[model samples]
Target: MSVIGVVASATGGVEQLREGLVRPLLDREHQVAITVTPTAAAWIAPAERWELERITGLPVRSQPRRPGEARPHPPIDLFVAAPASANTVAKLALGIGDNQALSVLSEGLGSTPMVVFPKVNAAHARHPAWAGHLDTLREAGVVLVEWELLEPRTEAKRELPWDRVLAAVDGLADQFFQGRLRDRGAGVADGGDG
Candidate 1:
């Protein structure tokens, strides 16, 4: 079984969690696990996990982990942090492994291909702190699927293209499961030819 790990922080969209991510992963019947930040638990309701359990028919594990410890797994095929919040994005980019999500990333990053779906505000995305982090993550072999494109005209997050996001996930799965991502000479777009 190809193990896939999904990480999310407190400040992003739940639709990213429900529809954009879990639905696509489960539709393929891949073994999936999720780790959420404490801030995210505070932001979402209990019923949300129940709904995920029903929709994905997979256990939604959200217990916070001790700082610096990665989740135990036999072998992970891919690790993706969708709707990655600015706070978490900066943390992961800097190699700070203080939580399960970050620790999982730190440990599992090179063992298999990983991706980060950044979903910060346009202002935050351009902030030097975050931009530098994005660069660092890219150099560290993390595939960045997308980020906020421009400043928000209103104080609300807009809907992202779920189909494209799923396509990216599917692309990553193909690369890792097919052993092409570790080839070191292939371009990122090699997997985008869908």
Candidate 2:
């Protein structure tokens, strides 16, 4: 199974993450590790941290990993930030790793396929700085997972669909598998399990 590192930020749509994103990954037999921003953790009513841990079977990280720690962050084939707030997105664009979620994103910037499902409100999205941040991420090879940025509160939050993200990851996983198979084939053909 492919492993996906999911970063959930503090946003209005954050509460829907488990059902919208994590459950689909589980159904697809993909392993998921979630890192919730400290602000998001607090925003979640009744605190779904324990529930998420149970569902994912991995500790839900909410703090940055200490340097030289014996244990390290779980390895993953892909990275995603869902319900990413304007603040989180901006920090990531600026390469700020001050928080756990952003730190993971910073590490995955180039090596891993990264997608961010932003949930910016009209007011925030219209800010002049928002465009610069997005541009920075684009230059860094990060894909901004987007849905219709319509008027907010008029309807349910229309962030990038979780299914869309899953489909994208599936394609990435296929590429990864094919690459590995090619490497293995090359080794075997060389008269060694290289």
Please give me the total number of clashing residue pairs in predicted model 1. 0
lDDT of 2 by residue, 1-194 (tens): 77888899988778888898988888889889998899987887655777888899888888866788754446878887887888899999888988889888998897787878788767777888899998888888777876666566775645457777667667776777689789999999999776
* Reference-based lDDT, residue 107, model 1: 78
- Tell me, by lDDT, which candidate is best: 2
| Candidate 1 stretches greater than 4 Å from native | 54-58, 64-74, 152-157, 180-194
Task: Give per-residue lDDT, candidate 2, residue 4.
Answer: 87
Model 2: number of clashes? 0
- Runs in model 2 lying further than 4 Å from the true structure: 66-73, 151-160, 191-194
Per-model TM-score versus the true fold: 0.78, 0.86
Q: How accurate is candidate 2 locally (lDDT)?
A: 0.81
Task: Give per-residue CA lDDT, model 1, range 66-162, as digits (tens).
Answer: 6897744335678878878788888887778787667777777556678887776678876767768888888888888774466656556667656
lDDT of each: 0.72, 0.81
